[model samples]
Target: MSFKNYISKLVFCNGISNSFKTFTALIINSKRYSSRFKKNTLDLNNNETFVYHLKSGKNKFKFYLRTFKGDIDIFYEVFWRKTYDRHLSFLKKEPVIIVDLGAHIGMTSVYLALKYPHSKIYAIEASSENFELLKVNTEAFKNITCIHAAAYFEDGMINFGNNELSYNQMISENGDPVKALSIETLMRTHDLSHIDLIKIDIEGGETELLSRNNSWLKLVDHTIIEIHTPYTPSDLRDDIQPYGFEIKSEKDSVLFAAKK
Candidate 1:
């Protein structure tokens, strides 16, 4: 690793020690099995939220994290381990357009904004609480436009399950209602002819959106989706194949589809 990356890892690992008990358990169990094993078995206190301000070179990011909510591990993976590093190389030019569905606290949007300085990004989040943080986290970037809405097949209201863990929030029939927007609406609203990339991680809502009339998918050049298992049909690959997108499954629940 480079000196900067080494320092970042050291800082992140050391910073988590503030939650001493949780940190201790993670250490002990991490030796016995894989990190995934520890993640599944560790008992983390969830009563309160924690904030961490992290820096990479001159770029700084503020994360409202909770171990119980798995935000800490996600921050570690995305920022420290560079889990979405592969997505960065897909955009080959400046002034590209990206739509970030399920933007969470705008981490991916921020990363992309910084990496592709000239790109215009629409960061969409469903949860009210997360949208507030998403706005705050991405405010410094002029290219990021944060939207408090869910990406759906239609432009209307939909029920959503809000939770402390932003990633776990999903569209449901029995949760708080939020406004939804279709890809076509988004493109028209933003006055964009085409989107270079659309990154989606809307829990299981992808099944409905992707399975529905996907004529708008033709306007997108690429997509990075995190498909929730079992809930998403196994034929999702086949479903998207006719759109001229070739699917490549990655580690975790991530899938990348590029127009062929």
Candidate 2:
């Protein structure tokens, strides 16, 4: 879909709108408010990458994005897509520890960092191109630690899908070899005793992440992960239910689990 058409279909998929409310949602909640630079402006139409400056509420948000590619889609999905918004009310003020499995050009990391200013966010990205942009986008935040490694079942060199597409990057035996960090290695390397929130979107790597006989799940309070094919929500629910998490809800493949 074209940039303009994608917005119309995505934001107004319900065909429900109010002129006053819909326009406001476009700024950060719904619409793609764009144009030249201003104090607090929005634009998701540019094809090139630039240091974008945006102000929402009292904070100024910055990100390096290529709007023509899938960057803006991910941006809108993370920053304004309502599917992820329901989880934010609980995290807005918490000084949580977050583990982002697929940082993807740092969209989730940057958005979460901005949302949780006191949070210590560990962003793991496997793509070299994405990691380069991740560093540029997240360099301003002191709380975010960017890790250029793929999340996998063990600590070793693993083949990773060339991240030509930002959201679908995954692990593959035929892809380029990259440093792999298991959940255990990540926790130990960062010296994290427990995590308040864990966001897993590492393409299809969740199979290796949760199917293992690992002890990390018990140490996390919350989890929001997208389950790719060959794995169902029931598969994850079965794996995590034993670890003390109750399945709160799900939207598509994204499941929300929290300790009860």
Count steric clashes of candidate 1: 0
* Count of backbone clashes, every candidate in sequence: 0, 5
Give the least accurate 10-residue stretch of model 2, judged by summed lDDT: 30-39
Which residue pairs collide in model 2, if any?
25-30, 25-31, 26-31, 33-42, 34-42
- Residue-wise lDDT of candidate 2 within 120-142, one digit each (tens)? 99999997777889998888789
Pairs clashing within candidate 1: none
RMSD of each: 5.6, 7.8
Candidate 2 stretches with Cα past 4 Å from truth are 1-48, 90-95
Encode model 1's per-residue lDDT on 1-260: one tens digit a residue: 57896567666665644455544544443333335435675343343454555445466655554445555555567655777777546645653898999998787888778777788999999988778778888877889999999999888999987543556888877779999988889889889899888888898888878888678887888888888867443566777778788875465677677878
lDDT of each: 0.73, 0.75
